[model samples]
Target: MTDPADGQAGSDGGHIDSFDDLDIAPRVRQAIADVGYESPSPIQAATIPPLMAGRDVVGLAQTGTGKTAAFAVPILSRIDPTARHPQALVLAPTRELALQVAEAFGRYSSHMPEVRVLPIYGGQSYGVQLAGLRRGAQVIVGTPGRVIDHLDKGTLDISQLDHLVLDEADEMLTMGFAEDVERILAETPDSKQVALFSATMPSAIRRLAQRYLHDPQEITVKAKTATAQNITQRYLQVSHQRKLDALTRFLEVETFDAMIVFVRTKSATEELAEKLRSRGFSAVAINGDMAQAQRERTINQLKNGQIDILVATDVAARGLDVDRISHVVNYDIPHDTESYVHRIGRTGRAGRSGNALLFVSPRERHLLRAIERATRSTLTEIGLPSVEDVNAQRVARFADSITENLGSDHLDTFRQLVENYARDKDVAMADIAAALALETRDGGFLMAPDPPEGERGERRERSPRRSSGGQFATYRIAVGRKHKVSPGAIVGAIANEGGLTRGDFGNISIRDDFSLVELPENLDNETLSSLRHTKIGRNPIDIKKDHGPPRTRGGAKRGGGHGRDGYGKRSDSWGKRSNPRVAGRGRG
Candidate 1:
């Protein structure tokens, strides 16, 4: 096997069928097999060899995809067991994960008595950790917060580090520990091999990857069930009257790098592609009806970034492996559950999270339920972006376009021209800018003005604002986009059918199999009974009061979170030490 980085021969590369193929110490292999790891998972198989070869790797896969062993096995194989100073640092998001990872290291190197590992985290005794540090450990696994605390006091050392791992990067991004993670990485030697594993690559994490990781090989592993835990599955309940419009609204608000829209028929693929193109989207269609050459060109255009969206039937999209595609829209419900899974799998590839939206009509409820049961994960229902949402996004995009041209050579010419016109008309610069904003958007909103609730009759019930909190119950509705539900229709059905006012409701969240609604806290039995047998559009809703104990009166968690525990120090640690500067321009 050859290395992609420096063209060096790697004795263990490509597929490995057994633990022995990993080329690690015999004791390490024995311990792995003793734990009953019969075979390496896809991520472990692909990543272990590159990592073991000392190449930087970025692992892309969903949660629970066996990422721990992928990096751990390789580092353990390469580490000098006799060294007492820490040579590797594993950074995780939470204290629990830190401990779990340290335990795994212990289990993997069970026979190697000289190999020492330390688990550092908040809520642990500092004296204990300091003693372990003084005694010297070869591997250190810690959460980012606690790791920074040690770095501040000059107690922990990475001057001789060989490996650095950033595990659960997406979780850290969510917990707002990205800055800490970056700072900690900066303190490490540049020669150290870096490995990062993330369930999703939102732009922030992507930027961090670009800054920190050297040229790295990318690997992606699909979930064992062939469905991704990272892709958000949603179904939009649309009447035939509004399917096209609902889809258009979605395109307006979504942030995607590339998109694929699937339809049942070849002709629908072409038609939808043309319709989207007419709306100024860079869209083209590929179908069984297209010539092979034409199909190839369309796919290439999508792959090369010339086109942003592809409209294709399942047959035409076979063997497609484009990682840039970030969204998969089932513009038409699939004939079966397998087709549904295959279509969405195209987007959420290489460990990047993708969004999947389905357009289900009134009679497609059973198909939606079948998909949910097969995937073993419930989809979150989301409302169509309102007119305000579309308008806000459009204006923001126009502002970006103008800002991009700010450094152009001819910008002064245009800037002066606008200034002269403003002076002649005695108008405010702000007024001139607002007029330019309207003109840039083509003198109209990106979408037609959304109809008021009364204007659309029963289907026009406006969604209530999301509740701030305070005992509003989260009710579950069996009906969803599968039943052609619009938020307006949901709000209307509940208000008129259940004798509740608009104020009695809060924001609604829909899923493929069901929908969640916020209702006034502690409604009377009479009102709750009236909510039964409520019909929206063509389907009757099976509504019930939901009981979720984890949620508090107003929605936020009771303790905020365990992540922000102040200064993870033991009570008796060398009297009261000043809290180290946690986040700023530079690390102490």
Candidate 2:
């Protein structure tokens, strides 16, 4: 059930290169081929073997590191598709992730038509879930709350469950689902094989593993970066909604022979390609979902100059070597820094100079910093292309076109026709030429209005800060003086786990039973959820929006009501008294 080399995830070992090197079912292998995946990611290569061997595994990996397929492929090999009940159960933190994992299982089991994978989560009708259950599912992927609800209702049974997976385990614990997860674990049979995957390992998650899992094989995948020195790296911080406008503007201003725009999802590749085409750019998409023949054809078109822009996902772009590529644009920032290095490496091949541009959102600055630190090269901050810059390029292109066509035989005929028209209409020849130029521009003016001043250099549309004269929202956490909690520990835990910077937090007031802290208003549900269950020194913060002054509902020490602490506490010097276990490494 466990390996002798337990708790040695940080240790390095030999890595597998291809899926064929690992033990997998024939049908599953065929599915992988159909998906166009030739090689296994580092996490997949390291995780698949131990999983197929039926050993408990604790995988330390990020969200976009191909961890889903890492477990799905091998689990499908062990699954008995003929069985009517659930043989494998996966617990995810959110419904979106639950659906994604279920889709992954279905994709890997495509060759095995008998296998049925079902996703059960909240926000769906109970009737649908019951119907899916009656139809018989070999694999069930659901959120912890819904899974527990099904267990209590006796509608789902896992007494004979053979495989269990906790996807984003740290996220589930941070969302305050610890008790629900334990309840589900208690109902499962002891013989079941468990696999836990988390971006970070906090003490709370480590304790959960220690109590429940057998000697598990701990596998840690660190972000490794290798970049070419000839490549020029730059970044522009913009919001998500403004990325397209920014991308198109860059395409107009930047001179690129051929370019690749990398996005995260397969659907995004197609979606972005369509948008770029609509904007008068020749673009195409390639993803794992595309057929091999179609993918090859698309690549050929890129190499043959049929298309100058290719929008692609990470997996589909692997092993892509195009000498003509002069630019690479990260339209969507990757979740891992290794991906950043790989994406930009597509260009600057064969010792040619290349340019790499990254688009970072306000919330994603941390990832940008991580990439910089890993690559040991600072990305130059760049501003958006001004309207004047775009107009200058357009004018130069118009002039070049005129020069190239001046000597053509066909141009003589057009010149004579234009002269006759000018004589017939008695109009100035210069006016005629200007009218023709307007028509050549598709009836759009060559010069456009300038954007608002400072729009070009606006890096981040920052949220109103609590330290400044801005609105604030008070939140209370369960940990306080009684838990030996410190402000630094609280800030470090929340900032590290919630992806918030030090500036995001405000004043801190530690009470006997609880502590109240002021934060910026309008925090997203996901961030709040993560901060709510984040722990400080072995205790869950249990953070919630404080409606009014925090008052003791039950017995505790005196001075129960929360008072106005103002924004007096410094965000830094949170004191070295911070607990080491409270902080977790940011996913690369």
Candidate 3:
């Protein structure tokens, strides 16, 4: 391999001027042209040349700076697709990201057609992944934990691995999977080409890179501006259950040419987009599952202003350079600072100011702080939208539409109909207009009352605390210490099942055969019924009263031998008890 310099400098300091300029295969250039990527990102520009030349690379780039293709193009170009052994291994911090990298490999290798890609993660069954490995997947993308599990089981064969990519290396370290990563890397061939990409190079990550990577080229991509300085960053500290409502309110009130809403999961992208469409917004979901053609159409719609909002996962929003996007709403706060930065970076582009709104549940406050520190930018606190704000925006939109369309030739018929209605109802024009305006508003005229002050805060506070006392009801679940069920699982299950606020539940104890959970005493029958049907792990709870038998009025069990601690025959237990009434009766 030749140490050739490509003129392309990607944002992350990689070179990608020309595929021919580097030592990559001719097929890679064809594939790159097919994908319509004329130039490489800085990370890609700098990393690809060194990687193709068999030199290890340490790249520092944020999530959306085209890092996957950087390593992927080089690895795929060098690997023998017919070998059918794992030649390239990419480790990601998350299952979703692992899957995303796998998909990118598949896309870039569409021309190759023989290169096989596999994604392994915790949620997937191990047996299936093992079978895939047996059949031969040339490239493997996996999380450290699952990959380690496979390695320990002897199901994964990395002995022939020629190239290794540690994507999000910093995140894996933070998640405490550093040891597993080290073990996995140890299994690779000694002559393997290693490339480590991270958003931030902490001391641990730097040390790991120094120990593992050979004389590697260092590349870094810094934000050109401080988190889109023109974009106003704000967050609504609402509970998860209330995020949809809050999002809807903001969509109605905020004016924008177009908006991109980032969600964490593919399911969330579709679900939220569906809800927004039902609420009469022109919205569509963009995810990895969508074909390139469909994704292009969606982006076209967004650019042409046909779709007012786009609900998308991080992967789908990559390489999006739409100038009309006036807002980027983090429907779900990203899992890491890198993802947060990428999500907000969609807006405030092309010298135009933009708006970024993040929806943060109280549990994710730590993430908020992390993002702030990483970006060196402050996120302003924004309260949930009031009914008045929604109403005012609705009215303003209605008035604008009327003003724009009232002079059109088509409005004569509607004008006549409105005049007829005014005459028939004996109402003035202003009253008629007011009635029409009220009817046109989406959430009906009356708004649900703002929840009591401090109620949401109290619920947030109760999220981590366990409940105690008979003041709360106890539920028995079959899974106990054996299933690794803990207080957190119990709490999460109940919260998800009952749709009850965290404050409504309390302490949980896991016994050998079952677990006891304390729920609020005033839980309505509907909530209790829902809880009973809610499944935790594979067991549905038998939600009932607590342990112990019935007690008498004197607070003594019916068949109890004695109330005293160890009085042999209940000797003088009641008679010797120091009580004013008993003493008086004895004297009499």
lDDT of 1 by residue, 1-588 (tens): 211111111122246777777777688788787766667766778898888888998877654456777788889989998788989999876554566578678778887788999988754557889999999989999867567768878999998899999887876655446656878888999999999888677898788788888998887765443477889888888764577788888998888899999976555787888999888799998875678688788888888999999998766675577999999999877744656777787888889999899987675666778778867878777787788898899879877887888879998898899999988999999999888777655665666787775778665355333321234777878886565454544554564344343335555665555677777676667656645654443355678876542546897544333442112211111100121111000100
Write model 3 residue lDDT over 1-588, tens digit each, in one string: 111111112343544566666667777777777767666666667778788888998888766566788798899889997898999999886666677788778777888878889998754555789888998999999877667667777889999989999997876665445666888888888899999998788999989988998889888865322476788999889876677899889988777899999976676788889999988889999987898899998899888888889998877887788999999999877755656767777888889999999888776787788888877899999888898888787667777888988779988897899899988988899988777776866446556677676996787677643322125565556666666554544554454344343344444555555666556666667766656654444555667656544667997665535542221222221111232121111000
Ranking by lDDT: 2, 3, 1
Query: What C-alpha lDDT values do all the predictions have?
Result: 0.71, 0.76, 0.72
lDDT of prediction 3: 0.72
**Stretches of candidate 2 exceeding 4 Å from the true structure:** 1-12, 15-23, 30-46, 63-66, 94-100, 121-131, 149-155, 228-231, 237-245, 258-279, 282-326, 342-354, 361-365, 407-413, 442-444, 448-588
CA shift of 374, model 1, Å: 8.0
Lowest-sum lDDT 10-residue window in model 3: 579-588
- The alpha-carbon RMSD values of the candidates against the true structure, listed in the order shown, are 25.2, 8.7, 12.6
lDDT of 2 by residue, 375-432 (tens): 7999999998877888899888888988989978899799899999999999999999
Candidate 3 deviant stretches above 4 angstroms: 1-20, 36-42, 56-66, 125-135, 148-156, 176-179, 182-187, 197-225, 228-242, 360-385, 399-443, 446-588
